[model samples]
Target chain A: MRTIELSDRQEKIIEIVKESGPITGEKIADRLNLTRATLRPDLAILTMAGFLDARPRVGYFYTGKSSTQLLSESVNKIKVNEYKSIPVVVNENVSIYDAIVTMFLEDVGTLFVVDDKSLLVGVLSRKDCLRASIGKQELNSVPVHIIMTRMPNITTCKSDDLLIDVAEKLIEKQIDSIPIVKEKEEGLEVIGRVTKSNITKAFVTLFKKD
Target chain B: MRTIELSDRQEKIIEIVKESGPITGEKIADRLNLTRATLRPDLAILTMAGFLDARPRVGYFYTGKSSTQLLSESVNKIKVNEYKSIPVVVNENVSIYDAIVTMFLEDVGTLFVVDDKSLLVGVLSRKDCLRASIGKQELNSVPVHIIMTRMPNITTCKSDDLLIDVAEKLIEKQIDSIPIVKEKEEGLEVIGRVTKSNITKAFVTLFKKD
Candidate 1:
């Protein structure tokens, strides 16, 4: 159950494979300015350690083990709530044009449309506004509710979901972000937003382990 | 200015607001059951055109004329990329204990490792032979170079690159998924991976209007 430790040289080799994988052993040794003989053991040790892969005719490559290791580690470390950001909102009575402006001013891609109760009832995005505008639709008279994506079917994530799980949902669903919602006695209310940028930040922190 | 055409209800509101904005009107007749009678004229016109804001006691709010309407529209029309599945890998010579068992038997993760040539050296997964019967430091003595993250930074994607830009890179980043990479001649080797279930997928497809 002892953890395997890597020497600096081995680490470099692993990094190189990870960087330029599916390369030849001779090429790796040449890049490092070491004799194939000198690099062979380094390569062998790395391969034995589950960091590199060697093929008969093909050169060496770095394995995908790093991602799994990273994923397993990320699951244990990141708390879901920490990754959420406050949701951007607009009033239900607001014009579709106004919603579009709000999206730009806030520098966010999506906007949540809410009622007087502050309960999320619909969602709007740049796309909805564009479609409306291109159709030469009346700007001042069109209510966003007509074009907004309604609730329930909206993709949402809970505050307790793990970062890894969130990442999985993003990829599987091919979504740019997920609305974080909380259930109250009346209905579901949007509390925050989790976007692709958040996942990237979380991964960067996770990978910087000592 | 020639006003855009709108639904009957929308047209009436626009006509009312063009003459009476910043003025709250009560009991305005609207078509169907869709209209609320006690609504503000400016708020109705602005909200529909993407320009009005609302406050609690202050009634409807207006933020001047809207700008950057085109940009929001463009963002909405952009197409998203699909997620693809790729194998996970690990080095061979490294300790087979922690990795071999945890990732392999799971049947979900794969392991890639590299050799001196930098070619895809070896491919291991939950199905790899050494999952059970894990030994002591013998695992450490084994080199991962034989089993680790492999060449080409497989699953590599680019920054500033759109979703489809790295769909191919997903297969290259030697792990269970493709990692987002910065644009570089070396293909921006995997900095962070895009998995089959990442949020990008949802943005790429589900939310897309097409």
Candidate 2:
């Protein structure tokens, strides 16, 4: 993770720049009771940091905060727990027929398979069930465990982890969703789920006017 | 779309900082034959733009280039043509069985469907074929077009388009891959394909040391 910070003097300089539109360095220096040479550093710092904009003769004006900075800032601060949705889980013993209905009812492309202990054991996608149903296979008899991508293959995220890292994992792994889980006394218990949909929702909110 | 430019003086200041470790404003001013005030703006710009680092008492030092800047820079330069993989294509009239074999043999989740004119007409995936083969349907007799997601609904990218936008579309639309295509007189012609794997590959390259 990276951090960007501003000192008290720097903050004050930004405020001054904000209040006075297109003010010159000499004027700012006069107000601060510092020589132009001494005040030069602070004004330069503010302008370079993107808080202030400088023209050849127009002096400095507030450029406002950049969208990219706001985005990176929000992504760093937002945690998975804040926006994660409920993980749609089905018992591993459930018949593919029952699981399919559960998936459709939940309107999810992937399903987390939990054992009787409610511990996440594996993951199964819509394609997995579809392929399992092929060749006159009986959907009522086949269990999801028979076709699931088992543990050690599953990728999970923590509740407190940064959202962009979770997003990076999603893109890197090419998986639709990640089960947000933690190690409980029993086992790996699913807390919530972060899917492409959740990330999309966050992206939509990023630039939206408050 | 925001542009950040480094002036010649700013670049020279960065070069000096790189060679000399943690030099002071007074020393830089002496070397540049400019007063400390005159050099303030350049130092501020360099530090603010992440080219340099500043501490009031410790003077200035180089922080090198930031990873975020490098990632964004590489993303801008890398187009679909550079990162895209050769698109796996199947004739629209081919049997679902043949298409399935092609898909599995190519180890791709999606296949571009081309008509007799060799123009992309649809897209086929394992789920599409699996669903069509249910209820006593024969894979040998089924044509991919019947089960495939047709054009006008398919998402595509151009060779020159930015790769990050492509990655976003892949996430937002929840599609596994996008066909990089060009418009021909007949229709859209598949040039290459950018899959989640391709994006992952590009991401892997991003952190690689030059």
Candidate 3:
């Protein structure tokens, strides 16, 4: 097998394809701010190299040798810390109404419930807030802790945990995100979070690596 | 790379690992109704073959080259129809009360709203019911269509769409599941549903194949 190092354009193209594949060359060209004629060489190279598969009218799909190797390397080599985003934190004592505002403001599906010391205590999801706020009129008086999934029950990942394992935990638990915590004397410290979006980012980076 | 054919027992072990990895051989044996002693050889073979990775205290994880290949192939080869589950359907005219009951009974996160002719019209999710039911006193009179995401905006997949592409759609849309539909004279006929669980199943099957 010939190892053809991908150029920046090629890498960017692969990233685009990975994200919204079964896409056309025209669309790919549009995303990269390039004309179809300018992208022909990269398209030909990617499709021929098996990094992409193109049907006559169906456009390009990511069905390549790299898909296998990249997925393998991602599972084995990438760790939770590598992809964890800063966790959206909220105090357990905060009113459910306040928590609702925070959740929407942060644009996160799940919020890490923390104590004053920043110790991870529980998790509040969109469903929890929505359920709690509905049917009642006391959103302000209701504490978030009442609706949160408390610790020791929440699925968490340490910084060193494999990305593959974290992804598995996400699927197994059917949760949107996993808090990346540090086990401390006080409790688990919420340093970061790994979300479903992180996995998608990983997929893009898998192709981005030259 | 040596292509070792997996025995049925080996395949089952891989399945268990994919579902819940970092599992101990003793646990695997217990689940399969075999003694730890009897399962040692298979575990050893798998570990030695690099299909399973074992740590002193971490137990076993699926870390094979095929995991990458399998993930790639699973996404590329498998279509929405192949692993799509039976969809939960409800008539658009059904009361929110009736829809809520059906949602619980079917154990589904979303319901396909169909017309009297069983043509897909809209989709209702757990959030929809939760939101509509809250602050409302007349679930019996309120119809589900009021809260549902109507068609032309619903994220859907055809039976022939690749599983990988479908997974992308799920993440991009951040929805629970996508209805696998077939275009018919009536409209888009809901055939089945594909979910995140289906992706995990594909992951296991990738290793299960000989």
DockQ of 1: 0.02
Number of the candidate with higher DockQ, 2 or 3: 2
Clashes of each: 152, 1, 0
**Ten contiguous residues with the weakest lDDT in model 2 chain B:** B201-210
Candidate 3 residue-wise lDDT, B121-195, digit = tens: 999987677557544547788888888999889999998987777777777797778999888987999999987
Of the two candidates 1 and 3, the one with more favorable lDDT, higher being better, is 3
lDDT for each residue of candidate 2 in B77-150, tens digit (9 for 90 to 100): 55768888999999989888788778657867789999988899998866576556554567889778888999
What is model 2's DockQ versus the real complex? 0.07
Any idea what lDDT model 1 has?
0.53
- What lDDT would each prediction earn against the true structure? 0.53, 0.75, 0.75
Error of 1 at A204 (Å): 2.6
Q: Measured by TM-score, how close is model 2 to the native structure?
A: 0.59
Q: What ranges in model 3 sit over 4 Å off?
A: A1-74, A130-138, A200-210, B1-75, B97-101, B130-140, B200-210
Query: What tier of docking accuracy does candidate 2 attain?
Result: incorrect
Q: Which ten residues in a row have the lowest lDDT in candidate 1 chain B?
A: B127-136
In Å, residue A179's CA in model 1 sits off its true spot by 1.5
Query: What is model 1's interface RMSD?
Result: 28.0
